[model samples]
Target: MGSGQSAPTERVFHNEIPISFSQDLVNRLEDNLSTPDTTPERQNTLDNHVRARIQAELARLQAEEVHVREQIEAVLERENLDREKALSGAGAGETEGGREDTTSGNVSSSALLQGDLEEVQKKVERFHVRRQLDNHPKVKDARDAVLQCYQAKTNTPLDCIDSVEQFKRSVAEMERQFVDSLRR
Candidate 1:
């Protein structure tokens, strides 16, 4: 022992564990730890499940699309059939009361009646105006008669022809129409 120093520091001992270990011990401890599951395997399983669900939804939507298309096609086909039936003159041969709408045939008759009524009304009006201009005292009475005749024939008042010139012009036009019709 050295002078003035204790013979030796008392040695300490512990049985729980050593403060440091060998490199091999640490390596062995790490190797004994359980490994985690593989990332690729777990990912693959999840991907397959997602893919199946997506495929099912796609199939369902596709079926709905097909159904909608079928309904549209059906409506279009019905419209086409109706169009074909109408274009083929299917309604032409159908008869009612021994006739199929003679409205077109009555046009000539109606025109003739209209022409006769107009001509008669024009003659009555011409006579009335001529009588009025001839210094007749019954001008008012003649005018009233002309007005009644015009209203009865045309279902219109005599307000359109306020002068003899207008009436003459109307008569000339009517005569020209009649002449043309005769020529035709």
Candidate 2:
């Protein structure tokens, strides 16, 4: 009506209009989608996916293990240096104790070095224990299995009963083995 062109239609709603398709085509699609997923090809695909995921997890754990090992080695080296310093300081004090002023200072410094060495040894032991646990195959496998179960069960750990039971069994077995080894 304006300048010989049709007027724009008045907008009724802000929502987008849904696309339409032929009902026959939609029915065919639904039928195809409803087919069972128990085919051998699908099973193999799932197996491959699981294998890839396990490999990725293993790689991540190995990297963490290496980093922890490096930290342990560094702590051990520092502990050794502290030990050497304390020994040398004690020797020097024995030679120089004729001067009363230096005797007190050397004793304090030696005590500090001994404390530092003990702290470093504790840190190294903690890292070593963590590395051992991380490298345990049963622990890793149980963790992975439980994680996968949780994912499959819609992020609910409570639904992973079998996995939790298996984990407990594995831990019990490990404890028994450790006890037997200790007895030996």
Candidate 3:
């Protein structure tokens, strides 16, 4: 009413009087015109019917989804098994003097062996310094001496050791030397 709008037309049916009352009267008039049976039991029954229908549909969809997932997993497992069998037959022809039918199996096995050889080569390259340590007399002597010192210090029980601090310092120095040697 404050917006300066014209008032709404009052709706009346079947020989009724015009309503010049408040908004609540319009609501009541509309409710009465709609239906006579607005009981709590009827409302609850409608709600329960809709809820049951939705629940049944949800269960049907879930079962279909589970069936599809199981089929996909089975197909994947079969493919993996076939691939593994092929890889195992890779070296058969070479071992049998080129007489075996090594198609997929031979190829996959050879590929796996090649991968293993490359990894071993990489490890050898990384440990080149450590592998050469055996040929150096000075490095070997120092390593043995440090290990001996550590073994002697840590050999006794804590209560039996007189100077725990001195032992700890010596052990720490030996550990530092071991790490420095590894770097070289």
Candidate 4:
């Protein structure tokens, strides 16, 4: 009734619009308006058409992104296979004269051997400690006496209190001797 140009209404779903979508829409709108055939009367119609096209473009880009990610994963898997093949090929060419290639694999193998050596050393140390404990005359006699007492009084362990105490004292003395030996 007045000037035929109503006031611009506030957009209802402003927050729902993505920045990229809005930017593309704005660029297209600018292009459409700059053309000679465009008129102010058809601006809304052109804007609607541009918005639809932008939505379609966003969907296409998302699909392309998923496809590109899949391709990247395939390429990485292929590269890993090639690397394994190269390592195996290098290992096959090594001569059996105890001459090993100086690759990371050889280094890891040496590390594994070192770990095994350390484990063996620990076992040897344990064996020596056990032998020393068993070979001590006092400890050996006390252990044998305790075992005899327990066998004689299986239902009454309390009766073997003296032997148990002797075994404990022998163990303490053996530990002291071991520590003294270590200090020397």
Candidate 5:
């Protein structure tokens, strides 16, 4: 049971039992048990030392957290500025005057961060549905003409050719206007 010792390390007889540990473990146990920290003065001193160490560590961690927060805030402010500049079309994907506006002087970081991105967010939301009908009435009239021509000339479809071409041209014009608005 114990590395096949020549002599039994532990002996137990009936209800009485004895344990034997290695020399190093026995010495460490004795050293811990025989410490003079049992006195009230030493015990109080040890407790105070532990408390001081804990407080110090907590202060260090709080300082580190403050530093990290400042860094994150700085980064957020910078990113907000970049987004504001891009959305305003000041640079329009050009990085030449990105660091500071040469013509308009230096833009304040606070001003950039002041926007809650509400305008930019609204524009982004509208971008997906930007193809709203600007001249819906005209397109609808052309489409109705094409449909009516197809209905009237079901037998000779070639007779509806002019109406179909008119409808296509109207739709093409609407698309062109939509594209132009996006450029602005």
Candidate 6:
């Protein structure tokens, strides 16, 4: 910059919330909806699920925001490196009239960026979500309890407190197990 003072640097913030948590939450909601029985609890659950989904979506957006900022930082770093190379090259290749030529440096940097973009596009084309295949029987039992309570206490969803607690415990236990497995 031509200014005497330096410009402020951009700061990127990262959220440590695992995206998998939201993914599993969505999967469980879908599983619950797969049941044939319709009850008032299901409606309430659906409403709650919708709210959860909105929150999950917000989290996903935040992740994307972080990713974009990281990409921008990477591009800026590359540009700085390219600028340094170009300046050095221009100095070495100065003409009799003191004109600096940087065509080669500019071309090479643009080509490098193009190659990177193409490689990224190729990887993106091959991307797919990995879905969990196994369903734990313990979780199945807890889901049944919640489902039963929903059917029985259609008028008063608060009656499903015990079942809901059990379901929460089961899911939390399963999530712990899943994370532990990944560590191994």
The clash count of every prediction, one per candidate, is 0, 0, 3, 0, 0, 0
For each candidate, what is the lDDT? 0.60, 0.71, 0.65, 0.76, 0.74, 0.74
Worst 10 residues of 1 by lDDT: 99-108
Instruction: Name the runs in model 6 displaced over 4 angstroms.
Output: 1-134
Compose the digit string of candidate 2's lDDT tens values, residues 1-184: 3754676667676648787889999997887689855569889999999999999999999999999999999998887667556555654443342432223333335555676678679767765665565466896688789889988888566889989888888777767765554443
Candidate with more favorable, higher lDDT: 2 or 5: 5
Give lDDT tens digits, candidate 3, residues 136-157. 5544555555566567767554
How high is the lDDT of residue 87 in model 6?
Answer: 58
Error of 4 at 142 (Å): 7.4
| Each prediction's TM-score versus the true structure | 0.29, 0.32, 0.35, 0.32, 0.40, 0.29
Candidate that would win on lDDT: 4
lDDT by residue (tens digit), candidate 6, 75-155: 999988867676556444766545344345454455546665786686555432112413777788999999999999999
Q: What is the lDDT of residue 174 in candidate 2?
A: 68
Candidate 1 — what's its lDDT? 0.60
Tens-digit per-residue lDDT, 70-165, candidate 1:
999999888765654453344334355443221232232344356657867976776665544434334444455566667665855554355434
- Taking the tens digit of each residue's C-alpha lDDT, what string does model 5 give over 77-172? 988777656655655233453433422334444454445366568667667556466547778899999899989888998998888888899889
The prediction achieving the highest TM-score against the true structure is: 5
lDDT of 5 at 132: 60
Model 2 ranges with Cα > 4 A deviation = 1-37, 91-184
Task: Please list the residue runs of candidate 5 whose C-alpha ends up more than 4 Å from where it truly belongs after superposition.
Answer: 1-110, 113-129
- Flag regions of model 1 displaced more than 4 Å: 1-38, 90-184
Instruction: Please list the residue runs of candidate 3 whose C-alpha ends up more than 4 Å from where it truly belongs after superposition.
Output: 1-40, 90-184
